[model samples]
Target: MKEVLLVGFGAVGALCTLTSKSLSRSGIARVTAVARSNYGIVRGKYSLCLTTRRSRVCNTVASAADQAYDYVVVTTKAVPELRLTPEILSPLLSPEYTNKFAQPTYLLLQNGLNVEKDLYNAIRKLNQGKPSIVCAALYVGTNLAAPNVVVTNDLVNHFSQRESLFLGIYRHEDHTTSANSADETALLQDLGSIFQRGGSAITIVPEIQRVKFAKNFWNLSFATFATLTGYTVPSLFRSPPASKDEQCNPYLYPITAELVQQHSIPAIKTTMKELLNRDPDNSHVPSMLLDARRSQPMEVEVIVGEVHIDMLYALLLVKQNQILGRMMAQ
Candidate 1:
């Protein structure tokens, strides 16, 4: 059976676990997930069946590395300021693991542009071979309410929209070519098939980085707006404030919304076009905003660093300084 290792078990990671479990049945694959602190909850979520073919969910990367994995799906956020991607993937990049097993294909399921370079370089150095990387732009509306609870915003009746997942094989050297080996292509297709079996809109595209650039463009666009305004992107779309709380305080309402459309929206687009381009579903909050609200380290480097929009980057840095300032005060 093919072996799959799923890293991270938070909001996005939990959803991926469901898909990984689906891939496990039918003698197709066996999954070993590194769930970290959520081990008990994640382990309890799955059934053992008292059989040998049951999947495994462990606490650490070392334990999950007991066997070789054919595919490594990392669903963690790209918070390079706190931890680099290569460091987060230390066990998988270790010479001990690379020397023992065939290099596993990596599937990175997160936002931001050019987040795969560090991991790609690390794997290339260790294996001395061409790396098989699958880059995707995933759009799902799920939030981690607490540690293990993930809430989605899939409304029905005239306002129903399924998630969008665009998968493509990535080569650091070339972006347009999918001339990867037949086996790699089959694996990528199979992965898309498995992810799509649950009704998500999954598309296999040839130009993935360009697609990622497009997705990241929207993310950074709204994210910068949120940081600058101290209001979520959904607020701009609420149309005179819909929520009970928002209805009470409607300052950042339609006029602010106009400013969003006229200024924030167009300026970011022009900046990206000059640079080379790239949120809806209003209930969803941008990840950077969420991180900022929690006083945690935001994903500045991966999301805003590449584009070099100095104004936006400075705003985010100021926000990060505020987070640090709060900690220092405490």
Candidate 2:
């Protein structure tokens, strides 16, 4: 059986754990989860009701790495500025684990640009074989909720009975790119098989980076603006157009049109398009906005700081500096 280590078991991780459970039942995979309550720093709680599961759950990454895991699926937020991903997984990358067991494939479920770089570099430095890294772009809304519980906000599609997942093997290039190696190709298929067995709608893409960059635009624009202005995605679509009266105006801030038209629109056109597509009533709070309000660290370094465009680079850097700088002071 494929031994899997889950680094985080929040909403996204729980949704994925269901699949891990399926893989376990089929004897395709076995899972060990690091299930602490966001290391006691986070306050959001999961809200899912599930049958009592029997998988091994540990309180920390060091304990969870007891066995040589075949796959380490990280669903934690990519906040390298606070704590680098490699630093978090140092125990797994340590000589003790590397010498004892086979190198594990990394399945990164975290959002942001080039989120796999740190872990990738760590494995590369080991000079073992090629690093097997799987990156996913998911279309699911989740909240950081109670321990061991997931707030299942209608993530599963009743029509298909599966959640959408876009998968790709990562290849980091400074200035050039190359084809996936034979081994990497096979590994990608193997991961696809694991998720497929769990009834996930998986689409293996050739250039996952492009898809990731496209997704980042939404964060750079909608997520950033919502975070800056303290509003939710749904506020952009309030009734009868935003007006002077605060009641009719949907935004927490009065400058609804000014926010959308002037800044967020240019950065990305995704938020309004999504609103036009699936009209949902649940609180569509941007994750970044929640982080800011809670006085927690945000993913500005990856989502904002990693933009390739020089034009946006300076702007994002300034914005992230202001946000993180304030946090540091506090």
Candidate 3:
């Protein structure tokens, strides 16, 4: 069985832990969980209920890594305080005496566009290389219901019980490998088994940047608007549309007024189409929006800022094609 080491015991970490338990039950993998809040390892056969399992809790990274792991999954938030730096993660990658672990795979289950890039640079800066890198875009949601317990939102209650949760590797200009590669194919198959065990669906795709950007379009637009307006997703939809007098009021910022006027919403919609080749109708509550409502620091720069540049580029391309009469009329 593959030995898995999970970092960050937050929402995503909790989900991964549960998934690990399912995997362990199937005899496909064994997992040890490490978190800043605590170092707790829970081991059980597949039949164990995640909520009932007691984690072998600890508080330090060094203490958690008494032995090496065959696969290391990092699920911490992108913020530096909770993030695992290369220095902290390096020892787990170490090949030393009494450590049976060899080059272990690294799976990053973080959000935003630069998750892999930041980790890659960090690993490179430390002169560490060996384990294959895999980037994943998690389309599941989890809530920290208790101090050590993470609650998984029933997807059926959220996404109309959609069978497949999208997972893929975000490809940049320099990285040319497709998700169809041997590593990804095998990983996808393994993930498929895990998802199936959880009664969920899995779709593995390459060109993850396109999906990431598409996801960002939904995450940022709602997040920026909601943060500025202090409205929840459901509440925003319930807000009455501004009348002309309210739209033209000089007291309101013109840009803000325009957004409220709904004139720019179509442009935002078009931007989503241009970036992801699809509209935003399928999107659920964006993480940033959730964070904003909870009074947490939002990833404005990472999610919105990074994708905003790309959105503008796409906008420019759209405009240019229209001027040249080369537009793809929808």
Candidate 4:
């Protein structure tokens, strides 16, 4: 049987664990999870539950080194504060264990662009046999409701209404022009089948980068604004007043009025339209806003820093164009 190790027990990780358990039930795979804390609690009483549903207990491992894993699914947050490499790899890739354990397939289920590069580099540095590295851009909405329980939103509608996960092998070249080799194609297909067997709706694509960027368009636009303004995703899309009197009413909540006014609505629409011009279907509550609400450090650099830099460059170019226009008029 295939042995799978899942790192992190957050919302995504918990969902993955449920999938792994389904695989285990089918006798195709056995699963274990590695959580940073609450080892005793998880080992004895760990359970994965949906919101308002019964809890199902899960298997927990204190350390990843306890057993050799065939696959490692990383579902941790893609924040720099977490020394991910050392924390994840040291137990499995240390000098003593590296030779004893076979190189495992590493599946990254994190957000942000180019999220797999650093971990991939770390694996290559091991100088062992190259392991298969797969990246997934997931669109499922889930939250950890308790230490051992994960609450998923609209799971029933996911299969019929929404695509859940997009899978692809990591490629440095532009995916639009790049084709996967026969071996890579086989690997991706196999992984996709495994996930499908576990009841996950997965689509294997040639270019996961495009999917990541498309998803990030919504993230960088709405998430950044929401983080700064303390607005929820649903709140941002509230219907505006149809009349000027209603729009200018001072009795309305200050922040709500500001957001729903014609002046602010146009700016919001322009920003969203600019970002989503390439992919209009992209929409989700920004994970960064959730982080801000939880008082966790947001992924400011990866999610918004690049966009902010591009905006600065555009301003500079506009300024230069204005100066050139004045010179021409003179």
Candidate 1 structure quality by residue, lDDT tens digits, 14-87: 76655432444435556677888788877776546213446778888877776778788888888776677789
TM of each candidate vs. truth: 0.77, 0.75, 0.65, 0.72
Model 4 segments beyond 4 Å from truth? Answer: 19-26, 47-62, 155-162, 173-177, 240-285, 306-330
Q: What would the per-residue lDDT of candidate 4 be over residues 77-127, giving only the tens digit for each residue?
A: 776544554455566767667778777888888877776777776777789
Worst 10 residues of 2 by lDDT: 42-51
Off by over 4 Å in 2: 18-27, 38-54, 155-163, 174-182, 238-282, 308-330
State, as a TM-score between 0 and 1, how close model 1 is to the true structure.
0.77
Off by over 4 Å in 3: 19-26, 38-58, 81-88, 93-100, 125-131, 148-164, 169-179, 238-296, 309-330
lDDT of 2 at 76: 87
Error of 2 at 156 (Å): 7.7
Clash count for candidate 4 is 0
- Indicate the residue-level lDDT of 301 in model 1: 74
Best by lDDT: 1
Candidate 1 residues lying further than 4 Å off, grouped into runs, are: 19-27, 44-53, 155-163, 175-184, 238-281, 324-330
Task: Tell me, by TM-score, which candidate is best.
Answer: 1
After TM-score superposition, the amount by which residue 150's alpha carbon in candidate 1 deviates from its true location, in angstroms, is: 0.4
> What local lDDT score does residue 256 receive in model 4, on the 0 to 100 scale?
79
Q: RMSD of each candidate?
A: 6.9, 7.4, 11.8, 11.8
Q: How accurate is candidate 4 locally (lDDT)?
A: 0.63
- The window of 10 residues in a row where model 4 has the poorest summed lDDT is 49-58
